[model samples]
Target: MDELEFMRGRVYGADHDDAAPRPGRVYAELVGGPLDGLLLDVTDRTERELRGGVVLPTEIGRHGPGGGAVYAPRGPGDRRFDWRGDVP
Candidate 1:
């Protein structure tokens, strides 16, 4: 399956553990890049000891100028994705 489906079916699935990343309603802010202003599905997050980062798995979103929708993976330390609110 695709990244989005895999993430949805596995990572955020009901069968997943409580520590697993829960899906959030709001889109995360993509910091300092062409991806700025573009929204992505807030999949999961890493803990503060893990450097406190947000996870953006494969999801349908605008890529950039002249670029159409695409499935992208923005993990911790990417410097491209950022979340300012409370983390779960």
Candidate 2:
């Protein structure tokens, strides 16, 4: 499997044996920062949610549990989210 396929299993869990995206489930690749290369499951998120971005907790982040990694979609048509930075 390729890097993304490997990450899909790692991020979504081992039970997800299939590399192909599941129907109705939206996924975006995280670019840069602590969560780089990880897939964010935005399946149930709305367009506003995607545009406003999200804060995800990560052990590798600068502030650990006190802060989170900020990620926002590059654009409406982009499938990758760029890391804005860490938030406290």
Candidate 3:
């Protein structure tokens, strides 16, 4: 399924217990940057965070543009994916 599809039709419970970074953010950063993925608006978060997290656009699954709020703080500023290039 696409990112949008995965995110659609339901609300993901914010899980703060997991210290791992948001997977959606990683995918966004990769797809929306030098990684060859479509670029996304930094303001567009990924999803609901349990403790303190980010949210990205839900439509990001298909790799189109904007679809819905996603809550993503790990995009570029979070410093999750480097080596490729400075995110922000």
lDDT of 1 by residue, 1-88 (tens): 6543334323221343542334554344344322333444353444342345433332232333333322233565442344332211
lDDT of each: 0.36, 0.75, 0.34
Which pairs of residues collide in candidate 2?
none
- Models 1 onward score TM values of 0.25, 0.73, 0.19
lDDT of candidate 2 at residue 29, scale 0 to 100: 83
Rank list by TM-score: 2, 1, 3
Off by over 4 Å in 1: 1-26, 48-88
Candidate 3 is scored at a TM of 0.19
Q: What lDDT tens digits, residue by residue, belong to model 3 across residues 1-88?
A: 8754443322233342542335454332322322222333223443433114334444333444543333333443462322222211
Poorest 10 consecutive residues of model 1 by lDDT? 64-73
Q: Which regions of candidate 2 deviate over 4 angstroms?
A: 1-9, 12-24
Candidate 3 at residue 62, lDDT? 43
In the range 25-63, model 2's lDDT, one tens digit per residue, is: 778888988778777777778887789888987767888
